[model samples]
Target chain A: MSIRARIDALFPRLASEQQFPTQGQTIFVDLERQEVRRAWIPHRVVTQLLGGRGVNMFLLHNLLDEALEPIHPEVPLIFGTGILTSMVPSASRGNVTSWSPESRVLMDSNAGDYFPSFMKLNGIDHLVLYGKAPKWTLLHFEGDQPKFVDAAPFMGLDNIDLRAKIANDFSGVEGKDYGLAAITTAGENLVLCSGIMAGPKAIYARGGPGAKMGALNLKAVLIQGRSADLSTARPHKLRNRDVAVKLLNTSVVKNALKKRGTPFLYKPSRMLGAMGTKNNQETTWTDKLDAENIDPYRPGMEGCFACPVNCRPLNDMSVLGESGVGSRESETPAVDHVAATPDTRQPTPIPDKYVKGDGPEYVTLGKFGPNVGITEVTQVLRLNNICNDLGLDTASTGSAISWAMELYQRGMITREQTQIDLEWGNYETIERLLFMTAKREGFGDVIADSSQAVATGKYPRESLDYLMAVKGLTQSDPHDARILKAFALGLAVATRGMDHLRNRVTLEINAKINDSPDFKAELYGGPVSAEPNSYEGKETAVRRCENIYAVGDSVGMCRFTTKLFNSPSLPGYEEFADQVANVTGIELTNEAIDHIGLNVMGVERLINAKLGITRADDTLPKRWFEEAIGVGPYKGEKIDRGEFDKMLSRFYAISNLTEEGVPKPEWREELEGVLTA
Target chain B: MLQTESRVTVRLPEPLREGRGDVITMNATSLGDIIAELDLADDRDELFNFAVNGDLVLHGEKDVALKYGDEVEIVVAFAGG
Candidate 1:
């Protein structure tokens, strides 16, 4: 049957009281028309897509114009719920999409729990918002209608307070649970680095979606549904839910993430000299590892929604307060310490009592710590809290700060002229600057615009050469490019600029080998191991990983669990295709799924191209090639431009791009065809 | 003839214990010679700044003579911001 016919048939059947189950209901609000419309997306489609990430991406690519810049007001903002969100057991991952302010590219960030399942119960496969609301308005979905309520009271509220207020207001609602995904003061102010917060702790914090929303004057998107029919799937469909539960409960998938979160992987990465430190100047910080209390292994495990793998850590902040340490996560403290304490002779010991909380993930630490040279645990916490409250992305904030510090160090700006004293390890100046950047105060205002912009006149253009970013997004995880060429290439070509999440080639390669002879061969370049330093098969490896990630994102599944758990084989695809076939009744093939991934990537590339991005935006910081650290596994090593160029050529070849690295006209035509059709 | 060997006591951070054996002792004519003999990774060097007795050693000028029982501390540099 045609997709349109299938959807038409299912919508009526699911919407009608006779055929519709009691657990679900449809609520529709048309803001522009000031009318209410309602419909249901079949449970079959939800099951097939496996919820949030997968379904959302599919809708987004279809709804938004691929050629438009990610930040354009015309770009659509999509909120989607996953198949197993509330019903099946495991972490519940919610997905959001927008043009990323940080990367200046297309991107999405995930939130945990309530939001996904709650939306699903309301009979929404996805919430698609296009164009800007005329004014600040609160979108409230209840029963079969969406109420456009006044949002003036909630306007300007920070994420934490906003969530508290929403929960308080909706406290009386029973099984009809709800959650708020809103922007903070920084986002409302349209700060370039702002992010959207979901609930108290979970945040869709990357890519500056908050800033995008603020620009459009979108106050908050509140998803609340009381329909009990959401859990009432058909008896036969219950079998699929059981399969999902078994898959999640199985030992293989949950063990890895549960052990030490994803941060544990850093041990091997560090040993291989692939860990990032101080904006990629140093690959490892062995001594600081203990002082900064950067442990891959820790106690307590938390998760999102029905996800069984509890990867989030519940941190203790009491010790941190006692030690005069404001922040107690892993990365921020490390970044602050390394950047501030440049001269090693007076090695300062971070007080053990000050170590508070759990993660400063690899990216957070790399950006916040060595990158900007401040080492106080308190200072990192302050920065983290400030960023959260201000609605700025911690990664971008750290990157920008590091860039400013380097510019100052290089004589690009005098200490007095820069306004803030950027001496390494000084908490006072760093603290002042964090708020300043959020408020666009003084030099902070100029720096918050972007590293590229700051590097323009604040520092000599040559000094900008040291920034390790692609487009405007800073590179996360300080792995040496020479050691992990595939990762470097992936970062360079990432759709949302330089990020580790989008194309995790390094982790994928590591997982594939898995303590076997095969692993050795891949790493060492022999039957035993492939040489990590060699770029020989890196392009192919990166391309495969990128494609898989894109597919996962478009399918609306959590990459953390889905990609890692179902490696080598994507178990859910057949079911996923079946679900799409049943709902839209479009017989989607595995090949079609692959096509969606590629198509999304192509669209992302088009978006960048429209923004006038070229090969220049794909390059890394020049310091990686020029500065050779005096010690460590990579002591004498540095990236050579010629070799990088060769690698880029190979990468372009795999993507079927022209020699100059532009997507081939034929490929573009093919993508355009798919889009139009 | 062996010049007076510096009795440098290297303190290992708790986290690095797994990588390097808990404690190591080495003899060298100068601090540079000791560093060369130890064959530590560059990341380790970035982590700790060496102090002889209580004075900081400047890079490149490795001529500080090591005397018997001369205390050397390998202090780990903190990076938390």
Candidate 2:
């Protein structure tokens, strides 16, 4: 039998006494052709690949003819959720994927909120959007059938307004009746940093997949499914369901999440000096961004669909700013502006109390604050809200603006070219620049396109290093590799580029909090050190973390939960595999689940490998390698080039790849069925 | 287990105070020893993540030696993407 046939044969029958939804189907919509088709994903493929990101990538790799230009109308964009999504214990995540306009590479982003569960409830596991909509279009699913409505009326509206409008159109519906995923005018204009916003403050905001959606003229997607919730299948799995339930019910993280939300990170991150200051010229700061400082403005906290860990904190900056009437804690920023007026010259000063949303997550906090030299938490909240309204990836947007400020300070760009004084920590210029970037106006246009902004032809060679990006994605998860070797390695080698979540070594990071060399040794399967800067055995730890996280992400669980990568004592294979068995009615061993993770990452690596990604791409920016971090305990620390190369080779080995970072031929050959399917 | 002889000073974050004063005393020698003795309720023992003077006893260290100084700073440890 062919390798594909053998793989399929292994999963021919459910590996349990109970049964699963083996007939999950795909909804294929051709926007350009204005047609739709439905097909069932073979049961074996579903079982082997699992779902969410893994399944989406599996289908996308097979369906593509060639790599489309990032904004090409024919780019296949997959919006998908997994088998156990919204089942319980923080599993309400969905993933979106396409060729990233930002990095010009294979792209995928995951978000936790309302959309994933609805997709599952609607019996729609995946939506492979093909071709382009001839006009502005809305894909609305009320039941099993989807209605393609004209999005003209909602065109040019920000994500929040557009979603509210769509929700209003489906009035008198139950509270859980529907969820929306939308793009703003930035997306409409094909801005590289545009992101799709879902739920309240939940955004799939990476890699400019939103631009792909807008390029197809697709606007809002309002989704609702009428099936019973996943509770129907919750009684089948053996062992530890009660223990899992108990952990979810009484976890301190969940309790703290209910109270402080993510805002709790504000002080600790700063205190540890694990922060990016002034675009990484410094990695620590003394500023007014502590939890005590911002608590008065915090009204409440929220959780995503079915999540008991209500960890999203609401930041009410409107109380401190222009206090607009619509600045209610739950509102998505502005209500005064419905459809955007297209005159770019008119600057919209952030109105009093204009910012009302949840979370100044460490991402937004790090990128917008000390990284860009803005210390005021109030402005960071407003900036975060503006990014939401304008449909910007806060990471990319903040990095781009910070990149520009560094150039301005160094006199790389004259005031004549900028038409404004580009100074660090200047809120006025920063605020105006944000609006302009969304509108793609003037200096904002230059700043918005960061890759173009720093191309050697446009600037000096030194400027490229200062951009603080790896593989074209800018940095700021507040992790500094100069002090944290694993962080540096992760930034260099993460498939998504410069992100900590993908493969960040979290297991040993907390070792310094007390001193658990024994547990650290157990986790690493070798003698382990508590030092963050130690290069010894970091690759093995990173690889282990990558595999665990890969499994968790594919299965639609949040990293912050009691799943794979949070605290060590939370649920791991025993609970997660059991939960899957209960929900899908297919028994899974711990090893089987781990194999799925390894298989999924191998597939993802090959997809990028086909894009010519290699060890050359698996590297940190020039600054991390050449410049020593200015402050913190490991001051003047930098990743030695030889050390990094050794780390990369070890990581590649762990991932079962060539030294160049390509998947071995056997793994690629195994995917021959998927490639040709 | 609160041995008055070898008692080490403990400094807890506000959320982990759990009715104990900010600066309390622990008789245990390691974070795990002290943590294992605390209640398994939502807020009490669950938040014993790290110790300042203990060098580095991070999540699930279960046993890392702690020494008495001015205080061994302990913080509520959590991580996110």
Candidate 3:
């Protein structure tokens, strides 16, 4: 028999018990009742939707009430781990899904760290929270029993302090014995731009899930499982070492990532003339904010569970000479690494201000640095640590500040409203705004809802025009997308609004790869797709990448571990299929995996369609079409309205959606079968 | 003769600037020639892209003839979000 035939023969029955690789149980938390229960996840749900964002989409579609507000007690918040989440390398991701308080649409946010893995190991593959709690509550899952604790003491604390307090009050070591997902005062205050801190540094920062958690009065969800015997606990074997070797050997970018973390992308973005400066009024900036400039303050690196890339850079508060946000209670920073010596050298004296945190990732750096017109790398790092401590989404916060600065420049707002001079690159004002927004103070409360929300009747129509948002969520990744048509198309059609992680085709910028017409034709459907400026084949590229990214998210694999984002050499459909087979003992062809991804998109579309999304909603911000890059190599680059419309139409066609941008009857029917199965 | 007389001003990112400095005044006829002259450890074809006079030069445009005083930027080929 053929290898495929043999594999199929081995799992021909697909016993219902084998469907769920992790405990196969979904924890149902009823906050209003202050009760918790467990249910077996249907085998059909596992087989059809896979897991993580895919299953989250299914749950959202079934449980969501279209008539109610996003924060309504009836609206459910679902958390899911991917089918392969803890079984493979770089597969340490989880998804939290709900109606977005920020965008007023279905929102699914993902984060990578030990939290997801720990949740699975503690016998929870899925969690669904229903109803609002009577008061602040903590859901604790230890062993098999799930219980609720009065979280009154944990309320109002930042994530940094929350974790420290949890350790003090709870029983168990943080990472080894347990893992947590918590919110800070930002979430507690229901700051629409707030995010949930996953473990120490990773965050589910998009779509206002943090605010939703706050609205539900859920302070934290802690899972405890110290000694999970993997040999008996899980059926699949972990191919971590083998996968790590394959990743490092195949992807050239992994080495650079290992060395400098994500800050390494700064130089390349600057070189492309795509780095957005001054709220994208300019596309380039001075080299003072470059990666090398930021290197001095980067003390070390960190990574998600089982991920070899370790792409998270550590910001050294000692080097930057500012005490980090959470270290306010004591003289020396509370972090352990800041005190430890590197190499044989004596440890440098802990500066008067000392703290340690992960990243100022590239997206954080760009949004906080040039996009807001801040040039100092130290200032950017400071802002990053502050945002991390406060549980604020750095991208949206920076965009909010930048939009205000532009409004200030245009004389739309004054000092009477803002209190502080909203000048470009005003470090003090920018820093102060983050604190205020987290606390919901004064003008900060206005901008905290999002740049789009601030522009109701309060600001002029031109102020709304200056707002760089799509579908209400402000733009992340400060790269000027107009220069790359595929990326531009992605921003318009992303399910979660103006986020780049949805469908950024980084391959568009790689010139050498674009040289091969055959490769372009095979991957993106036409030779013209290789050209960054060309609109002809861009729709196809975006459609393909959207599917790839959807699949990556569904599987809990980081985009960095796949060819979708940067490394063309990393795993794609064929490799993912192999991993799935090894993990589940179920055979899934590359085409079947691709269909699963397409179906995942269909479910998301159904939810959005229920929320009333039209073709008009799938579009770029007006600024992208009206203004060209004012300076840099990409000067004069702007999206042509006619071409963009054509691209949108083509994208809809390729995605099996109507010109209205909603999934067609046939596609919806097909998805319905999988969802109901 | 004009190609030899042409003095292209080439700008380099920090990694390539070691020993050679940040900017270089080089006598090269084309983008490929300038790349060939640089002391690079990685394959120039795969590792870098070039820009002339502040415009990104695409794949097929590398052979575009260079003129005197043209400013060239050597960009490392990388992408991320």
TM-score of each: 0.72, 0.86, 0.89
> Roughly what TM-score does model 1 have, to 2 decimal places?
0.72
- Model 3, which residues run further than 4 Å from truth? A1-18, A226-239, A250-252, A320-355, A452-462, B1-27, B34-47, B52-58, B67-73
Q: Individual DockQ of the candidates? A: 0.03, 0.21, 0.35
Error of 1 at A9 (Å): 23
Docking level of model 1: incorrect
Model 3 chain A weakest 10-residue run by lDDT: A337-346
Instruction: Encode model 3's per-residue lDDT on A1-677: one tens digit a residue.
Output: 32123223423223334343443466667788876655655666555567788888876776677888887766878888876787788888989999998888768888987788787676667788877889889888786467788999988888777888988888666767787898899898888888888877788889887889998889998888743333333233455566767677653444456767677667667766788778888788777877777777778888887787787888886754444332221333233322221111223333322156778788888988888887777667777877888888888888888888888888889989787778887665676688788888877887777754553455666677888888888888888888889889999999988888888877777666676668666776555555678897888778878888888888888877776566566777776677766665556777777777777878888898889887888888898999887666567889999999998998888889888887799877877765543
> Order of all candidates by lDDT, from best down to worst?
3, 2, 1
Specify the highest-TM-score model's number. 3
Error of 3 at A300 (Å): 1.2
Weakest 10 consecutive residues, lDDT, candidate 1 chain A? A337-346
What digit string (tens of lDDT, one per residue) describes model 2 on residues A107-172? 788887787777877777778786678889988877657788998899878766676776677772
Q: What lDDT, from 0 to 1, does candidate 3 have?
A: 0.75
Candidate order by decreasing DockQ: 3, 2, 1
